[model samples]
Target: MIVAATPADYADRPLYAPIAPMLRRFPDGLPDLATLQRLLEASAPQAVSGGGRPVRFVPPDDALPAYEARIHASGEVPTRAGDWHDFFNALAWCVWPLAKSACNALHVRELAAREAAGLPGRGSRRDALTQFDECGIVVVTTDAEIPALLAAHAWEAVFWQRRAALRETTRFLVFGHGSWDQLRQPFFGLCAKAIHRVVDPAWLRLPAAERQTETDAWLAAQLAATLPTLTPRAFSPLPLLGIPGVTPDSEQADYYRDTRQFRPRRA
Candidate 1:
C-alpha cells in the first residue's frame, strides 16, 4: 500500500541524514564508475566503441560547431529517420555529467601518470560524450517523472535534474516553479500536467518541516498510481552502468544487461 507522503518526506529528513538509503535492486550495481568500466572492459569491451559505430572525438577546435549544429538541427522541428538520430542526439545532452565520469575513467586507464595538463578535459572525448547523450542512457528508472519522458527507450533529463535540485531546501525554494516537463515535451502533456501540475510553488515556500511533511504525503499518494520507488538512490532502480540505446530484442541488448530493462509490464 502507498503511504501519504510528499517529496519533502524524502527530501527533508535531517542535515546529516536528509537522504535515505537508496533501495536499489539490480543484477549488478557498481559502487563507482571506475570499477564498473573495468568490468565492462573485461566482459564487453566492444561497448567502448559504441557497438562499432566508430565514435570519433569532435576536434578541440570544432567541437562547438558540431554541438551547435546539433542543437539547431534538432530544434522544435520534424524530420525523417536520417535526421531523427541527430535530434535524439541533441536531446540527450543532459546526460553529459555521467558520460564525463566514464570518459574520466578511460583517461585514468590510458595514462600511467598525469600532469595537471594531462587531465582529461571535456575536449578529448566530445564524440563519445555526444553519442551517449544522443542515445538514451540506461539509468535507474522510476515513475514520478516517467510521464515526462520523450520516448519509451529514453528518459527526460529534466526529470532527474528536478529531483536533484529539489532535494535541497534552498534550491527547492528558487526552482520550485520549474518542473521537469518544461524541459521536454511529453507524449501526453494533458496527463502529465494533470498529474504534475498539482505540485505548485505554494508548497515550495512552506517551512522546511512543513514542506517535508506535505511532499511526503503527496509522493506517497502518487506511489499508489505510479511505479515510484521511494527512498534516496542513484539515478534510478535499474543498474545503469553507462549509455544504453533502444533495443528491439534481447539480441540487440548488448551494451549492459545490468542497466538495460525490458518494457515495463502494464496490467
Candidate 2:
C-alpha cells in the first residue's frame, strides 16, 4: 500500500533489531547477562589496537550481572527510543562513564602509542577520569574524590587487559591527576612488585638537577614531540626506564586491586 510513515512512526523503529528478543531471553522475559553484553558488544564494539590482540567487544561475564542489576534496579529500561542506550548507561555505570564513547578507545590507544615511543607522558591522569564526571572540574575537593579515583582504577584494569593485545607499544607514560608539589610526602614510597618506577610530583619540580641529567633531557624532548597538549613545566625522571611507568593490567585478574593501590595518592 506504500503507507506514508510519519515522524512518530519512523521513531518507532528499533535501533537494533534483536533487542526485543534479547530483552526476553531471561526466564521471566527480563534482562539477562548474555543479552546485555551482546547489546553492548554490537552497539559500540571495541577493536584490537595497533594490529595486535584478540578482538574484545563483549563485556566480561563478571561485568554483565552487575550491569543487569543496575538497569532493572534503576527502572530506566527504554521502550521508546532503543534498548541500547539503556545498555550504554549500564556499561557507563559499570565501567567508566565514557565506556560507550569511541574516545575511550581512541584516547587510550593514541596515548599508548606515544608512550611506547619513549616520550614524556603524564601519570596520575585523574583529569581523564574527571572528563567523565558530571562536574568537569573541581575548584575545591571533597571526600568523594577517593571513591572516584578507585572507580577509575577499576575501569583501568579492563582497559589495560586490552593493552597487552597491543603489539606496537614499546614505551609510554600514563598517569592521572594530583597536586603540584606534594610528591614524596604524599606520593608514598611507591616501590612495587608489578610496576617499579613511580614518578613523584615533587621530582618534576626539581629544575637544577634535571638540566644537568641526561635522562631528564631525553624524556623532556620526547614528551614534547609526542604529546603537544601536555608540555612539561619542569624536568622529571623517566618512570618507565626499567619497568613500565604505566603498564596496562589484565581485566580478568586481581589487576583492579593491584592497580588502585598504586594510583598516585589522592589530594
C-alpha RMSD of each candidate structure in angstroms: 21.1, 21.9
Q: Best-fitting candidate, measured by TM-score?
A: 2
Q: Residue 254, candidate 1: how far off, in angstroms?
A: 16
What TM-score does each of the candidates earn?
0.20, 0.22
Q: How well is each residue in 177-213 modelled by candidate 2, as lDDT tens digits?
A: 1210111122322221111122333443545224123
Question: Candidate 1: TM-score?
Answer: 0.20
- Residue 85's lDDT within candidate 2 is 28
Question: Candidate 1, residues 139-216: lDDT per residue as tens digits?
Answer: 112333433442332322332333343233122211111122121221211111112322444655665446544443
Q: What does candidate 1 score in Cα RMSD to the true structure? A: 21.1
lDDT of each: 0.27, 0.29
Name the top lDDT candidate: 2
